[model samples]
Target: MLKFTTNLILLFISVTAFAQDSLSVETAAIDTVQVQQASKDSTVYKQRYGLRVGIDLSKPLRSFLEEDYQGLELLADFRISHNVYIAGALGNEEKTTQEDNYNFTTSGSYLKVGLDWNTYENWYGMENIINLGFRVGASTFSQTLNAYQIYNTNQYWNEIQSGIMGEDMLGEYSGLNALWAEIVLGMKVELFRNVFMGASVRLNYLVNNTQAGNFPNLFIPGFNKVTDGSKFGVGYNYSISYLIPIFKGNKPQKLPSNNQQEQED
Candidate 1:
């Protein structure tokens, strides 16, 4: 009976040691996994932040194809934060319009300043943007009274003139200016490396204009045509820009698993 008890006690000790060894191994394995996860969580990715400069692709291309329109526009933006950018455009336009009783030309340069908000949630390693923007714009431009035939309601006199009114008609209407505001919707896609392609549509409201005497302001350079009773205009641009990365930013990392964190603590 004593011998039997001794053997049983020895077996119990051996089993307990084995169980303790197994537990230790499991604990060590868990600690190793936690360490690996923590290391992965500490990894950082640098985001690109900089100034982007480009030209309006549509304007130049249109100028090449349209005889009545010639335009050039430069676009630029500086990324100030993760989802915010300061943007603007500088442009010159000369457009000729022929109407039933008039043909006129408007030429001018304009500048706009605005801010853009990026609304897209990009995937990992992707930096495309869907944006909503606002701008306040001003233009200094002039209109030329090219040629006009006086529209007389009474046709009693068959005299219709279709040439410039006088020597003073073909020159610029100096000091004519305008101010406006716009809401823009756009998207930018990274095409290759730091190059991007973007398009935006603008809804504009004319705030004010300085017109020339006798002849109404038919067209304002950046604001487009002035309608009979409407103060609104619509415009759009397609662009290709190159980003010059000025700095790198790091996005906030996600938190580690609570259970793992607690175990570590």
Candidate 2:
């Protein structure tokens, strides 16, 4: 933290000392002018363009067999208004497994439209940003056990099959696929005027679950109602961003426009 403060102080001193180089003014009057008008807005950070790259700290929306506990992402945002922005993102994930019952791995990618609301302003205090987002994408997963997984549970079918006896008592079925929808919430903190860090949590609900062959009126993972079990789960992401201003810096040096300005210049 000390290093951080030291760097900030140095940056201020450098900007203050050099902002005058743009001027042909005398050295003695330079310090005086700064004291009178360094910058009108000194406590806020706003930007026209933002870029963020970070990692997910919780599970991803991929299939359980290849789901990642952590992953990385790269994103870009364009501020459309104060506290509002449009964003585009892309990411990747990987895994290695020992058992061959499932696909070696599954990866996921998504696009989201989100809203950001500034809840607080003090960068070092409780400064917070609330982010709400929605995403659409696909994931990968597969089951390689048997035609009929020895331990399959079907609430609807189980009741109907109970009456089956003899040869009809035993049968087999295929597996399922992975594709889903995502919803997210996040908060950000300013660690530097142009830099910030934050945490995010998201929920994913599967969108497809094909049943055994072409069964009539059957349910699946992303398909019809197979079970009442919660079809959703939780995950988290950690991110950092940089915000660079549009057209302003320390205000430009000026030439006297009138006698009053002549004395100040």
Candidate 3:
């Protein structure tokens, strides 16, 4: 009977120990989940959203390198959403071109307004951008007819094209205007703290142009060249900019753990 009683006592002790071990394991799991939840609640990361302003470095460099070209442009953008930016540019240009039959100078100011969408997905803490954007551009300018040759196809009298001095023909025409739209593809890399360098190529289509009476506009300020038969033009700009952070936005919340949540449920 003593042996049977001792055996019962051993069995009771084993059961009690097993129960305590199970309780301890459950308590540990609960505490782990509570700590994770607290961490999630306490940790928050925000993204910087702000305005960026800069200058077109290409235009200034061109003006310095070329005697007949002078240009300046200002670029700016404001981040309104995670990938959307409201952007624009303002500039003035004066260029002189000498063609086989004519020489002309164009001078004017232009403005472009548009929006850019960042298409690239960046790693955390990186602000590099690949963007596709659109803009509506307008310009008010003047053209000076330097010189031209009138095409005379009549070789019967051994007379070919006749050269005419631009001073004799209406010298300068003012109050000319043009409007266009552009699609811009660009990339920007952050080179230093809040400083970025970028490049963009623009495909422009002419919407309307006010011809200067009898002289066709050979070159519109922002809209580069006007060929005899084409309405499309191409341009590019290299830029440097500084970003100003106006505010910060919370990043998207991470999804919860499935196993831990299932245990709690």
Write down the TM-score of every candidate.
0.78, 0.44, 0.79
| TM-score-better candidate, 2 vs 3 | 3
Top model by lDDT, which number?
3
Worst lDDT run of 10 residues, candidate 1, spans 161-170
Candidate 3 lDDT, 60-146, residue by residue in tens: 999999999999999999999889999999999999998877788999999999999999976556778999999999999999887
Candidate number with greatest TM-score: 3
lDDT tens digits, residue span 86-159, model 2: 65445544333323122122223334444444433333223246767665544333322222212235657457
In order, the Cα lDDT scores of the candidates are 0.88, 0.47, 0.90
Model 1 per-residue lDDT at 76: 97
Q: Is candidate 1 or candidate 2 better by lDDT?
A: 1
Model 1: CA > 4 A from native: 1-42, 156-171, 253-265
Ranked candidates, highest lDDT first: 3, 1, 2
Candidate 3: regions farther than 4 A off: 1-43, 156-168, 253-265
Ranking the candidates on TM-score from highest down gives 3, 1, 2
Instruction: Report the error of model 2 at residue 81, Å.
Output: 1.1
* Pick by TM-score: 1 or 2, better one: 1
How well is each residue in 1-265 modelled by candidate 1, as lDDT tens digits? 9999999999999999999999999999999999898877665568899999999999889899999999999999999998999999999999998977668888999999999999997755778999999999999988887777665556555656433245455556778999999999999999999999999999999999888887777788777778868889989999999999999999854555677789979
